[model samples]
Target chain A: MKVRVEVMLKDGVLDPQGEAVRHALGTMGFAGVESVRQGKLIEMDVAEGTTDAEVKAMCERLLANTVIESYRIEM
Target chain B: MKVRVEVMLKDGVLDPQGEAVRHALGTMGFAGVESVRQGKLIEMDVAEGTTDAEVKAMCERLLANTVIESYRIEM
Candidate 1:
């Protein structure tokens, strides 16, 4: 089965990399770009019937820094 | 309006970062992890009714490296 995990910074956190991208965009004349946030997309080919709980555990353990980020799974 | 762009490396390209993460997972005992690929998730706050063409241009010019990456946009 194919599973995907999208991990993103939680609200109220500062994202320096995202800010750098936004700055570069402004310099490139992509004006009026209000805000930008960058995140991660992890695609996995796991065993068939991998349970949601197992995937959640993976996120909790290694896939995300839950202290500063949040993640969601799709199958 | 909110928009998202997902960027990923072409299949034939090498991803050192992804390989590093996979190695880390293996050391942490995540067995049976067949394959993993990592990508980027970019979220944006743009003008309402931003055209698809505009977003596509953004991907081509900045969000993705067209030589080695492909991107998908969602609004």
Candidate 2:
């Protein structure tokens, strides 16, 4: 079974990388690019029968940085 | 309008950061964590009337690394 996990910086967290990209975009004349934030995505082929709850638990338990990020899963 | 963009490494791309995390998880006794890949997410509060097509254009034109990653948008 294929699964996708997305981890993104929580609101109110500082993202220097994102800011850099935003500035670069502005420099390159990209209008309306107000901000940017970077995060992570993980895709894996888990064993068959892996439950969504279990995958979510994996995210909450290890895959994400909860202090600075939140996660979503697609199964 | 609020939008989310998710950028993830394309399949078969080597992900050193993910490998590192997987190793760490193993060391910390996390079972069943077969693999990991790192990516990025960007969220923006665009002006009202921003269309999904425009948001997608932003992603393809700048926000994502299209060569090694793909993006999805949420409005």
Model 2 misses residue A70 by how many Å?
2.5
**Alpha carbon RMSD to native, model 1:** 1.2
Evaluate residue B47 in candidate 2 and report its C-alpha lDDT on the 0 to 100 scale: 67
lDDT of 2 by residue, A4-75 (tens): 887888889998887887787677665676777777777766667878887877788788978788998988
Give the residue spans of candidate 2 off by over 4 A.
A49-57, B51-57
lDDT of 2 at B74: 83
Q: What is the clash count for each candidate, in the order shown?
A: 0, 0
Q: Model 1 over residues B33-70: C-alpha lDDT tens digits? A: 67889999999998887789878888999999999999
Off by over 4 Å in 1: none
The prediction achieving the highest lDDT against the true structure is 1
Q: Which ten residues in a row have the lowest lDDT in candidate 1 chain A?
A: A24-33
Write model 1 residue lDDT over A1-75, tens digit each, in one string: 888999999999999888888888888877777899999999888878778988888899999999999999999
Q: What is the interface RMSD of each candidate, in Å?
A: 1.0, 2.7
Query: How high is the lDDT of residue A1 in model 2?
Result: 69
